[model samples]
Target: MSRYREIKYRTVTSFQRRIGNPILKRLPNQTLLETTGRKSGLPRKTPVGGRRIGNAFWLVSEYGEKSQYVRNIQAHPQVRVRIKGRWHAGTAHPMPQDDARARLKTLPRLNSAAVRAVGTNLLTVRVDLTN
Candidate 1:
Protein backbone atom coordinates (compact mmCIF):
# COMPACT_ATOMS: atom_id res chain seq x y z
CA MET A 1 0.00 0.00 0.00
CA SER A 2 1.23 3.42 -0.93
CA ARG A 3 1.43 6.19 1.63
CA TYR A 4 -1.67 7.91 0.22
CA ARG A 5 -3.81 4.77 0.08
CA GLU A 6 -2.77 3.75 3.56
CA ILE A 7 -3.74 7.12 4.97
CA LYS A 8 -7.01 7.07 3.07
CA TYR A 9 -7.85 3.61 4.36
CA ARG A 10 -7.25 4.63 7.94
CA THR A 11 -9.26 7.81 7.63
CA VAL A 12 -12.23 6.24 5.88
CA THR A 13 -12.40 3.17 8.10
CA SER A 14 -12.09 5.26 11.25
CA PHE A 15 -15.00 7.41 10.15
CA GLN A 16 -17.10 4.37 9.35
CA ARG A 17 -16.28 2.67 12.65
CA ARG A 18 -17.04 5.73 14.78
CA ILE A 19 -20.02 7.09 12.87
CA GLY A 20 -21.46 5.18 9.93
CA ASN A 21 -21.48 1.68 11.44
CA PRO A 22 -23.23 2.43 14.72
CA ILE A 23 -26.17 4.02 12.94
CA LEU A 24 -26.36 1.55 10.10
CA LYS A 25 -26.37 -1.42 12.41
CA ARG A 26 -29.57 -0.19 13.99
CA LEU A 27 -31.56 -0.04 10.77
CA PRO A 28 -34.16 -2.72 10.30
CA ASN A 29 -33.29 -3.40 6.69
CA GLN A 30 -29.56 -3.63 7.24
CA THR A 31 -27.97 -7.06 7.09
CA LEU A 32 -25.57 -7.81 9.93
CA LEU A 33 -22.57 -10.14 9.78
CA GLU A 34 -21.78 -11.76 13.12
CA THR A 35 -18.38 -13.27 13.73
CA THR A 36 -16.89 -14.52 16.94
CA GLY A 37 -14.07 -12.37 18.20
CA ARG A 38 -10.82 -14.23 17.60
CA LYS A 39 -9.35 -13.31 20.98
CA SER A 40 -12.26 -12.27 23.15
CA GLY A 41 -14.47 -15.15 22.07
CA LEU A 42 -17.45 -12.82 21.92
CA PRO A 43 -19.80 -12.23 19.04
CA ARG A 44 -19.18 -9.05 17.06
CA LYS A 45 -21.64 -7.72 14.54
CA THR A 46 -21.00 -5.47 11.59
CA PRO A 47 -23.48 -4.04 9.12
CA VAL A 48 -22.91 -5.44 5.65
CA GLY A 49 -24.50 -5.48 2.24
CA GLY A 50 -24.98 -8.73 0.38
CA ARG A 51 -27.49 -10.93 -1.38
CA ARG A 52 -28.90 -14.29 -0.46
CA ILE A 53 -29.00 -16.81 -3.25
CA GLY A 54 -30.53 -20.19 -2.50
CA ASN A 55 -28.57 -21.64 0.44
CA ALA A 56 -25.71 -19.19 0.38
CA PHE A 57 -25.04 -15.52 0.92
CA TRP A 58 -22.29 -13.76 -0.98
CA LEU A 59 -20.27 -10.70 0.09
CA VAL A 60 -17.06 -8.98 -0.86
CA SER A 61 -14.79 -7.66 1.85
CA GLU A 62 -13.21 -4.36 1.06
CA TYR A 63 -10.04 -5.18 3.05
CA GLY A 64 -9.78 -8.99 2.83
CA GLU A 65 -7.74 -10.47 5.69
CA LYS A 66 -7.15 -7.09 7.25
CA SER A 67 -10.80 -6.91 8.18
CA GLN A 68 -11.58 -7.87 11.78
CA TYR A 69 -14.53 -10.02 10.81
CA VAL A 70 -12.46 -11.85 8.23
CA ARG A 71 -9.78 -12.51 10.83
CA ASN A 72 -12.46 -13.82 13.14
CA ILE A 73 -13.69 -16.15 10.43
CA GLN A 74 -10.15 -17.35 9.95
CA ALA A 75 -10.12 -18.53 13.55
CA HIS A 76 -13.70 -19.81 13.48
CA PRO A 77 -15.41 -20.46 10.19
CA GLN A 78 -18.84 -20.74 11.80
CA VAL A 79 -20.81 -17.51 11.72
CA ARG A 80 -24.29 -16.07 11.88
CA VAL A 81 -25.77 -13.58 9.49
CA ARG A 82 -28.87 -11.54 10.08
CA ILE A 83 -30.78 -11.16 6.82
CA LYS A 84 -34.17 -9.51 6.54
CA GLY A 85 -34.51 -9.70 10.33
CA ARG A 86 -33.88 -13.43 10.56
CA TRP A 87 -30.66 -15.07 11.64
CA HIS A 88 -28.99 -17.84 9.70
CA ALA A 89 -26.03 -19.95 10.77
CA GLY A 90 -23.32 -20.48 8.21
CA THR A 91 -19.67 -21.09 7.48
CA ALA A 92 -17.63 -18.28 5.95
CA HIS A 93 -14.97 -18.93 3.38
CA PRO A 94 -12.59 -16.43 1.85
CA MET A 95 -12.39 -17.03 -1.88
CA PRO A 96 -9.12 -15.56 -3.00
CA GLN A 97 -9.55 -16.75 -6.58
CA ASP A 98 -13.00 -15.15 -6.96
CA ASP A 99 -13.33 -11.90 -8.85
CA ALA A 100 -14.36 -9.49 -6.11
CA ARG A 101 -15.34 -6.66 -8.43
CA ALA A 102 -17.50 -8.87 -10.59
CA ARG A 103 -19.06 -10.35 -7.46
CA LEU A 104 -19.82 -6.87 -6.13
CA LYS A 105 -21.71 -6.00 -9.29
CA THR A 106 -24.07 -8.87 -8.55
CA LEU A 107 -24.83 -7.53 -5.05
CA PRO A 108 -27.04 -4.67 -3.88
CA ARG A 109 -26.10 -1.39 -5.52
CA LEU A 110 -25.78 0.75 -2.39
CA ASN A 111 -23.44 -1.67 -0.66
CA SER A 112 -21.48 -2.46 -3.79
CA ALA A 113 -20.94 1.24 -4.31
CA ALA A 114 -19.68 1.73 -0.73
CA VAL A 115 -17.44 -1.31 -1.01
CA ARG A 116 -15.99 -0.01 -4.26
CA ALA A 117 -15.41 3.41 -2.83
CA VAL A 118 -13.57 2.44 0.36
CA GLY A 119 -12.20 -1.01 -0.35
CA THR A 120 -8.47 -1.38 -1.03
CA ASN A 121 -7.82 -5.12 -1.04
CA LEU A 122 -11.04 -6.56 -2.40
CA LEU A 123 -11.84 -10.09 -1.26
CA THR A 124 -14.74 -12.45 -1.84
CA VAL A 125 -16.51 -14.16 1.09
CA ARG A 126 -19.19 -16.79 0.69
CA VAL A 127 -21.22 -18.15 3.56
CA ASP A 128 -23.06 -21.41 3.19
CA LEU A 129 -26.38 -20.98 4.96
CA THR A 130 -27.47 -23.83 7.16
CA ASN A 131 -30.82 -22.14 7.77
Candidate 2:
Protein backbone atom coordinates (compact mmCIF):
# COMPACT_ATOMS: atom_id res chain seq x y z
CA MET A 1 0.00 0.00 0.00
CA SER A 2 1.14 3.50 -0.71
CA ARG A 3 1.83 5.80 2.22
CA TYR A 4 -1.26 7.91 1.45
CA ARG A 5 -3.63 4.93 1.24
CA GLU A 6 -2.20 3.43 4.41
CA ILE A 7 -2.67 6.69 6.27
CA LYS A 8 -6.21 7.07 4.96
CA TYR A 9 -7.03 3.48 5.93
CA ARG A 10 -5.77 3.91 9.46
CA THR A 11 -7.53 7.21 9.93
CA VAL A 12 -10.88 6.06 8.57
CA THR A 13 -10.83 2.74 10.49
CA SER A 14 -9.92 4.42 13.73
CA PHE A 15 -12.84 6.82 13.46
CA GLN A 16 -15.28 4.08 12.50
CA ARG A 17 -14.19 1.79 15.34
CA ARG A 18 -14.15 4.45 18.01
CA ILE A 19 -17.19 6.44 17.05
CA GLY A 20 -19.20 5.50 13.97
CA ASN A 21 -19.90 1.80 14.53
CA PRO A 22 -20.99 1.95 18.15
CA ILE A 23 -23.58 4.59 17.41
CA LEU A 24 -24.85 2.98 14.23
CA LYS A 25 -25.19 -0.51 15.70
CA ARG A 26 -27.60 0.74 18.33
CA LEU A 27 -30.17 2.07 15.91
CA PRO A 28 -33.24 -0.17 15.80
CA ASN A 29 -33.52 -0.13 12.03
CA GLN A 30 -29.85 -0.34 11.19
CA THR A 31 -28.88 -3.33 9.08
CA LEU A 32 -26.32 -5.45 10.88
CA LEU A 33 -23.92 -8.17 9.90
CA GLU A 34 -23.27 -10.69 12.63
CA THR A 35 -20.13 -12.74 12.38
CA THR A 36 -18.69 -15.14 14.92
CA GLY A 37 -15.41 -13.86 16.19
CA ARG A 38 -12.56 -15.89 14.80
CA LYS A 39 -10.60 -15.79 18.06
CA SER A 40 -13.20 -15.27 20.79
CA GLY A 41 -15.97 -17.41 19.30
CA LEU A 42 -18.43 -14.70 20.19
CA PRO A 43 -21.05 -13.10 17.99
CA ARG A 44 -19.89 -9.74 16.68
CA LYS A 45 -22.58 -7.60 15.13
CA THR A 46 -21.63 -4.74 12.86
CA PRO A 47 -23.88 -2.11 11.36
CA VAL A 48 -23.81 -2.21 7.59
CA GLY A 49 -25.57 -0.66 4.63
CA GLY A 50 -26.90 -3.11 2.12
CA ARG A 51 -29.86 -4.15 0.04
CA ARG A 52 -31.65 -7.48 -0.15
CA ILE A 53 -32.78 -8.87 -3.47
CA GLY A 54 -34.55 -12.19 -3.78
CA ASN A 55 -32.77 -14.58 -1.39
CA ALA A 56 -29.55 -12.64 -1.11
CA PHE A 57 -28.24 -9.55 0.63
CA TRP A 58 -25.45 -7.57 -0.94
CA LEU A 59 -22.95 -5.28 0.76
CA VAL A 60 -19.60 -3.71 0.16
CA SER A 61 -16.79 -3.80 2.69
CA GLU A 62 -14.86 -0.57 2.56
CA TYR A 63 -11.69 -2.14 3.88
CA GLY A 64 -11.97 -5.45 2.11
CA GLU A 65 -10.18 -8.32 3.94
CA LYS A 66 -8.69 -5.88 6.42
CA SER A 67 -12.08 -5.32 8.05
CA GLN A 68 -12.48 -7.35 11.25
CA TYR A 69 -15.92 -8.58 10.24
CA VAL A 70 -14.56 -9.67 6.87
CA ARG A 71 -11.76 -11.53 8.61
CA ASN A 72 -14.33 -13.27 10.78
CA ILE A 73 -16.27 -14.25 7.66
CA GLN A 74 -13.06 -15.69 6.27
CA ALA A 75 -12.78 -17.84 9.37
CA HIS A 76 -16.46 -18.78 9.44
CA PRO A 77 -18.90 -18.15 6.65
CA GLN A 78 -21.97 -19.05 8.67
CA VAL A 79 -23.54 -15.80 9.82
CA ARG A 80 -26.68 -13.84 10.49
CA VAL A 81 -27.90 -10.56 9.11
CA ARG A 82 -30.28 -8.19 10.81
CA ILE A 83 -32.24 -6.31 8.19
CA LYS A 84 -34.96 -3.86 9.11
CA GLY A 85 -35.39 -5.25 12.61
CA ARG A 86 -35.49 -8.92 11.60
CA TRP A 87 -32.64 -11.41 11.62
CA HIS A 88 -31.93 -13.99 8.97
CA ALA A 89 -29.35 -16.76 8.87
CA GLY A 90 -27.00 -16.78 5.92
CA THR A 91 -23.60 -17.67 4.50
CA ALA A 92 -21.17 -14.88 3.64
CA HIS A 93 -19.03 -14.81 0.55
CA PRO A 94 -16.36 -12.12 0.16
CA MET A 95 -15.81 -11.36 -3.48
CA PRO A 96 -12.51 -9.69 -4.11
CA GLN A 97 -12.84 -10.31 -7.81
CA ASP A 98 -16.13 -8.47 -8.16
CA ASP A 99 -16.45 -4.91 -9.34
CA ALA A 100 -17.03 -3.21 -6.03
CA ARG A 101 -17.56 0.21 -7.55
CA ALA A 102 -20.27 -1.08 -9.79
CA ARG A 103 -21.78 -3.01 -6.94
CA LEU A 104 -21.87 0.18 -4.89
CA LYS A 105 -24.01 1.81 -7.55
CA THR A 106 -26.65 -0.79 -6.88
CA LEU A 107 -26.69 -0.14 -3.10
CA PRO A 108 -28.02 2.74 -1.05
CA ARG A 109 -26.76 5.99 -2.48
CA LEU A 110 -25.64 7.71 0.71
CA ASN A 111 -23.72 4.66 1.91
CA SER A 112 -22.28 3.98 -1.50
CA ALA A 113 -21.01 7.55 -1.65
CA ALA A 114 -19.50 7.26 1.80
CA VAL A 115 -17.83 3.96 0.95
CA ARG A 116 -16.47 5.26 -2.29
CA ALA A 117 -15.15 8.32 -0.56
CA VAL A 118 -13.28 6.54 2.23
CA GLY A 119 -12.75 3.01 0.99
CA THR A 120 -9.22 1.98 0.15
CA ASN A 121 -9.57 -1.65 -0.80
CA LEU A 122 -13.21 -2.07 -1.66
CA LEU A 123 -14.67 -5.59 -1.67
CA THR A 124 -18.11 -6.97 -2.44
CA VAL A 125 -19.81 -9.37 -0.01
CA ARG A 126 -22.87 -11.41 -0.85
CA VAL A 127 -24.91 -13.20 1.77
CA ASP A 128 -27.13 -16.02 0.65
CA LEU A 129 -30.03 -15.82 3.05
CA THR A 130 -31.54 -19.17 3.87
CA ASN A 131 -34.72 -17.75 5.26
lDDT of each candidate versus the true structure = 0.94, 0.96
Please report the TM-score between candidate 1 and the true structure: 0.98
lDDT of 1 at 40: 99
1-131, model 1: which lDDT tens digit per residue?
89988998899889889999999999987899999999999999999899999999999999999999999999999999999999999999999999999999999998899999989999999999998
Q: What is the C-alpha lDDT profile of model 2 across 28-47, one tens digit per residue?
A: 99999999999999999998
lDDT score of model 1?
A: 0.94
Local lDDT at 42 for model 1: 98
What's the count of clashing pairs in each model shown? 0, 0
TM-score (C-alpha, index-matched) for candidate 2: 0.97
Error of 1 at 83 (Å): 0.5
Candidate 2 residues lying further than 4 Å off, grouped into runs, are: none
Location of the lowest summed lDDT over 10 successive residues in candidate 1:
4-13
